[model samples]
Target: MDFSVRTVRADEWERARDIRLAALQDPAAPIAFLETYEGASAQPDSFWRERTEGGSESGGGRVRQFVAETSDGRWVGTVSVLVERPSDEVRFGAPAKVDQTHLVGVFVRPEARGTGVIDALFRAAVDWSWTLPEPAIQRVRLYVHEDNARAAAFYRRFGFVATGETVAMPGDESAFEIEYELPRPEAGA
Candidate 1:
């Protein structure tokens, strides 16, 4: 399938909501995402609007959501990045000790698995993270549920390594999420 990955626009909030709802329905949603389908689907239109706006291409460099859209306009995958700064309050897990990007909200439709759509989406997201102005991001990181082998394998193949850090799942203390990191490439290499 032919697809192009690009940062979502602020006006495409409805599309963003639709894709998120679809993601929450995926089998891995329970461990892969922090929210449930029921919880997210219950949100009002304004909530989605604000979410998309905050993650849109013009979100003042705080966040960016990349979407993989097919030739016919269907969205098949998405990945979002949230910029983390040392002085900024932590949103999840722990406070940032240095400038970094947190990868989150990753989802690719079931049918699109192994189709390279994910690779395309990550290219857009990682490229965006590296291009930020002064205080360039030192790395990009994400948390994967310890039991999510599929996701962990993919992250490893994509060059992310475990950082020996783990955090208890927000609402489920019995399980933990492990941290993975991909340090920034050296200058000119």
Candidate 2:
């Protein structure tokens, strides 16, 4: 593909908001994301501004969002990662026993699916995770809805193995999300 993948800019919140709304409208959003179109659409512009900036390259570095933009300047896909720490007051899934990155908000425009965009976006996200300073991120993880076979298969192909942990989906407790992780490659191995 001719698209370029990079961390989002703090100043591009509008674009970020636009792409996210598009993602929430995808047919699989119910299984793929925790937020709904109605909920997201109701958020004020300030909410999106903070949300985008929090994950931008110039943001605090605890989170990052990557986007694939075509040569014509259209964003075709996106993926976001949040740093999780053992001492954090809140937890997304199981408390992090070690520093880790939680991958979320993965999506691609239908027309852009299966064209290598997802692979490139993941490379950016995971590679960024490996470069964290200090103790260094021990692993990168993501949760897939139990019934989302397509996402699970792709995650496996990308080297994420189930850790045998499952968390009830936020809104639908009847459904669950399975956790997957890719431990950092050992140095000099």
Candidate 3:
């Protein structure tokens, strides 16, 4: 499967929404995503259109969403990176890990899993983080539920390391979300 991984186009919001809804329907959806498929699927088409457009370059960079599309133009997976500033707002902690990108909403269709689409999507997201100019990100990070061992293994294989950080999962005392980080590059990546 020769797939092209690139920043999503504003016009493809429906495609993006479709893949997300599919991901949320997977068995591991509870551990893999923050939202339920039911919620996202119920959203109006206009909402998805606006959401996808917001992640495009024209939207001033609040979020950067990448998608993996087959050679024939079918979108199969997606990931979103949210930029964070170090001086004030911190994610999950007080110090605010300065100048970083938060990886979220990662979803690769089950049929596409293990077919290298994941690496392509991740490369797209990681590469995008390294290109930011202002506040120059120092790292890219994500949180995964401890019980989601499958995802944790993949993150480690992709060069992300556990950062000794853990956050209590809301409503789940027995399980915690662990943080993983990939050091940022000093120059254009």
> What tens digits encode model 1's per-residue C-alpha lDDT throughout 1-189?
889998899999999999999999998999999999999999999999899989986778699999999999999999999999999998888779989999999999998999999888877888889999979899999999999999999999898999999999988999999999999999999
TM-score of each: 0.98, 0.97, 0.91
Cα lDDT tens digits for candidate 3, 8-83: 8888887888888888998998988778888898999999999999888876897899988899988888899988
Better-scoring candidate (TM-score), 2 or 3: 2
Q: Rank the candidates by lDDT, best first.
A: 2, 1, 3
Give the range where candidate 3 is weakest over 10 consecutive residues by summed lDDT: 88-97
**All candidates in order of TM-score, best leading:** 1, 2, 3
Clashing pairs in 1: none
* Lowest lDDT block of 10, candidate 1: 52-61
lDDT of 3 at 152: 95
Counting only residues 3 or more apart in sequence or on different chains, how many pairs clash (N, Cα, C under 3 Å) in candidate 1?
Answer: 0
How would you encode candidate 2's per-residue C-alpha lDDT over 109-165 as one tens digit per residue? 999999999999999999999999978999999999999999999999999999999
In order, what lDDT does every prediction score?
0.93, 0.94, 0.86
Which structure is stronger by TM-score: 1 or 3?
A: 1
Query: What is the lDDT for 133 in model 3?
Result: 92
